[model samples]
Target: MNITKNTTGIESVILTSPDPQAAAAFNEAAFGLGARLQVRAGDAPTSGFRGFTLSLVVPGPSTVDSFFESALAAGATTVKPAKKSFWGYGGVLQAPDGTLWKIATSSKKDSGAATRTVDDFVVLLGVEDVKATKQFYIERGLTVAKSFGSKYVEFAAPAESVKLALYGRRAAAKDAGVAPEGTGSHRVVFGGGLGTFTDPDGFEWETLA
Candidate 1:
């Protein structure tokens, strides 16, 4: 397969949920984003975190608070309440279908800063072998921004594109304060310029033709 460098990162993600419509609606409202592709897996058992969490980075505390509140109103359960941290304000939310989300802002309020879209969006995938998966993407032309031994890794994608991260499966679940539930259909469809492929962890990535 010819893996072109995907400058757009992830254009969309197809999630498998017992209630596909509810999952779609929750995501659209919570992320202020939309998916380009949709697929349904009839009545599959949803499990914890599913080895990934979608991240949204905004500008300041207000945006974090607002987005967090909006997520709750949209039927997402609060995994972590928004709080101020050294990095900025952040929080976590779990959609009805067991998809975890982390919303954060690393920048302080700057009155002179022009309003823009969310600062960054990322798809954090948990894998059993970070080194191998990291190498897989590296061979496919993904630049690495930061890496820590074999435990964690981050890829360098465009600012406007969805970034990718890798973490140990158990560690990722712990980070989300959930138990590691091993092996099930993650039901994720990736949309961009890349082709369809399944990672070592059974997470699926599909692309736009």
Candidate 2:
């Protein structure tokens, strides 16, 4: 899965779970996502479903409705109703790729946010031609932030940001600044006021604020 973000921050994650509804319920009860969007994923050999979407509780009411409408017009569905409740506004949507999503609103403002909430991160794969990758993101409506040589690049996405790093099987192994005894996929995690994780391929991701 390639997660790309630019400024907005990652509102949610869409994955293939054995039980989408149950997974949504578990997440909602655990993290307070208010609702779930329904998208059917074939068990197997069913040629797979068309698309998928999963929503996460966000901080405001801003353009959520409009966002949903646009998403829907671009091929989305309302598997569940959106309503106001103790949590906030809750809704569910089906993404164009048969992904299920649950979206909710949070009213509490962070007392310490000098800017916005310093939370969440998305990991994106990078190509050896990082300049081209960065340009690609810019053309795709994402904001390019940092490019660290042909070895890595980073982009900003709505609600979340993305980190892209070039991974040449042999070159990266040598660039690790370590003895290349054993290597496959590696993981790096950073935690503090914000938390982040790097995939085996050196892409960094975080969930915070």
Q: What is the C-alpha RMSD of each candidate to the true structure, in Å?
A: 4.1, 15.9
RMSD of model 2 against the true structure: 15.9
Error of model 1, residue 193, in angstroms: 2.1
Between which residue pairs do clashes occur in model 1? Answer: none
Error of 1 at 39 (Å): 6.2
The segments of candidate 2 whose C-alpha lies over 4 angstroms from its true place after superposition are 1-12, 29-118, 126-131, 158-209
CA lDDT of every candidate: 0.73, 0.40
Across 164-185, the per-residue lDDT of candidate 1 in tens digits comes to: 8899988888767678885556
lDDT of 2 by residue, 67-103 (tens): 4554465556676666665766656665443444455
